[model samples]
Target: MERIKLHIAYDGTNFAGYQVQHNQRTVQLVVERALSKMHRQEMKVYTSGRTDSGVHANDQVLHFNSPMTLDCSSWRNALQTLLPKDVKIMHVEKVDESFDARKSAKEKVYRYQIINQREYDVFKRLYEWHVIKPLSMERMRSAAKLIEGTHDFTAFSASKSNVKGDKKRTIKSIDIWEEGDGRIIFEVRGNGFLTHMVRIIVGTLVEIGLGKKDETCITQALETLNRQVLGLTAPSHGLCLWKVIY
Candidate 1:
C-alpha cells in the first residue's frame, strides 16, 4: 500500500467538527466513508489537527494508505464525486510512508476575522464575528506583539482542554491588520496551539481593543497562568485553520 496525502478545504458551518462522533456529521467521517467506498474496505484518514465546530479550513492536510494505483488526478476526481459540496479536494499526491500529517507538521496558521460595524452583513454573518463597537487597532496590535515568542499558554487555552502534559507552545508571530470594509483580521502562526488557544487570544485582544482590558493583562496572564486573567473566548465561527506547514 502507498500513502496518499490530500489537501482539503471545507466550509464548517454544518458539520459537528473535524473528527468523527457518534450520530454526528464530521469532515473525517465523510471523507473516510468516501475512501472506504473507493477501496471496498474501511479506510481511516489521519489529519494534521482538529478544528472546532463552525471553524473553517483553507488547507487542512490528511493522509491515508490505499492499495489502489490510481493516479493523483484520478484520485482527486473520484473523491470529489463522492464528497459533499461543502468539502473540496484541493490537491492529492503520493507520499513516503514516513510522513504522518499530524506528527510531521512544523507550523500552523490560524486566522480570525471580525466585522467591526454597526450593521452586519447577512452573507458574512456565519463566517465573521460581528462586533458593533469600534475597535482600536493600535491597542490590539500592541497586545498581539506581547503574545509573540514562546510562552506557557495555559490562560489562553480552553479550560476543558484534554491536554494534560504541556501547555507551553511557541508562537512564531501574530499579525493584526484592518481592511477598508471595517474588517479586522488576526493571523497567527505558531508551532502548535492548545484547544481554543487562538480564540481566547483573539477575545483578549478584542477586549483590549475595546478598552475593556489593558495590554498589560497579556503579560499578567502569561505570568500568572490564570484563565480568569484573560478575556472571553472568541466564537468558533470567526476562526479558520488557514494553513499547515510541514
Candidate 2:
C-alpha cells in the first residue's frame, strides 16, 4: 500500500464539517466517496484538522493509504470529476507512509474576516462577518499581543467544547490588519486550537477594537475563565482554515 497526501480546499457553507459523519454530508465523506469510486475499494481519509459547519478552507491537507498508483497531477482531475464543485482537490502527491495528516502536522493557521461597515455586502455574505461598529485598529493590535504565547486558554474556548486533557495551547501569533472599505482581518497561527477558540478570540479583540474593553479586561477574564466577559462568538462562516503546516 502507498500513502497518498492530498491538498484539498472546500467551501464549508453546505457541508456539516470535515470529518465523516452519519447521514449528513461532509467534506471528508465526499472526498472519500470519490476516492473509493476511483480505487474500486473503500478508502479512509484523514484531515489535518476539523472546521465546524459553515466554515471554509483555503488549503486543507489530508492523507490516506491506497494501493492504486496514479499520476499525482491527474489524481486531482479524476477526483474533481467525482466530487462536487465546492469541494475540489487543489493538488495531490505521494508522501512517506509514516506521514499522518493530523498527527504529523506541526501547526495550523486560520483567518477570521470581518466587514465593518454600515451595510453588509451580499456577495461576500457567506465569507465574512459583518460588524456595524467603528473600530480602533490600534486598540485591537494591543489586545492581540496578549495571546501570542502559551497560556491556559480556557477563557477563549467554547463552553460546550468538552475537550478532554489539557486546555493550554501555544499561539504563535495573532495579528490584526485593516483593509480598505471597512474590513478588518485577524490572522492567527497556533500549534493547536480548541473549539471556537478563534471565534472567541476574534469576538474579544473586536470588543477591544470598539474600545469597549480595556487591556485589564483581558487579564481579568483569563484569570476568572468567564465566557460572559467576552463579546459574542462570531459566526462560523467568517472563519476559514487558511493553511496547515507539517
Candidate 3:
C-alpha cells in the first residue's frame, strides 16, 4: 500500500464540524465515504486537526494508505468526482509512509474576519462577524503585540477542552489589519493551538478595541492562567484554518 496525501479546502457552513459524528453530516464523513466508494471498502482518513462547526478551511491536509496504484492526478480526479461541491481536493500526491498529517505539521495559521461597520452585508454574513460598534484598530494591535511569543495559553482555551498536557504554546506572530471596506482580519501563526484558543484571543482583542479591556489583560490572563480573566469566545463562523505548514 502507498500513502497518499491530500490538500483540501472546504466551506464549513453546512457541516456539523470536520470530524465524524453518529448522526451529523461532517467534512470527514463525506471524504471517508468517497474514499470507501473508490477503494471498494471502508477507508480511514487522518487529518491535521479538527475545525469546529462553521469554521472554514483554506488549506487542510490529510493522508490515508491506499492499496490502489492510481497516479496522483487520477486519485485527485476520482476523489473530486465522489466528494461534494463544498469540499474540494486542491492537490494530491504520494507520500512517505513516515508522514503523518497531524504529527508532521510544523505550525498552523488561523484567520478571524470581522465586518466592522454600521451595516452588515447579507452575502458575507456566513463568513464574517458583524460588529456594530466602532473598534479602535490601534488598541487591537497593541493587545495583539502582547499575545505574540511563547506563553501558557490556558486562559484562552475552552474550559471543556480535551487537552491533557500543559497548555504552553509558542505563538510565532499575530497580525491585525483592516481592509478599506471595513473588514478587519486577525491572523495568528503558532506551533499549535488549544481548542478555542484563537477565537478567545480574537474576542479579547475585540474587547480591547472596544475599550472594555486593556492590553494588560492578556498579560494578566497568561500570568494567572485564569479563563475568566479573558473576554468572550468569538463565533466559530468568522474563524478559518488558513494554512498548515509542514
Backbone clashes in model 2: 0
lDDT of each: 0.95, 0.88, 0.94
lDDT of 3 by residue, 137-232 (tens): 999998899889999999999999998898899999999888878999999999999999999999999999999988898999999999998899
Worst 10 residues of 2 by lDDT: 213-222
Give the per-residue lDDT of model 2 (tens digit) for 1-246.
788889988999999988778999999899989999998999889888888988999999999888877888778789899999999788888999889998998989999999999999999999999999888888888888877898888888888897788988999999888888888889999999999999988988888888888766777767887877777787999999999998
Question: Which residue pairs does candidate 1 place in steric collision?
Answer: none
Model 1, runs deviating above 4 Å: none
User: Can you tell me which runs of candidate 2 are displaced by over 4 Å?
Assistant: none
Q: Local error of candidate 2 at 47, Å?
A: 0.9
Residue pairs clashing in model 3 are: none
- Sort by lDDT, best first: 1, 3, 2
In candidate 2, residue 181 scores what lDDT?
87
Q: TM-score of each candidate?
A: 0.99, 0.96, 0.98
lDDT for residue 9 in candidate 3, whole number 0-100 = 95
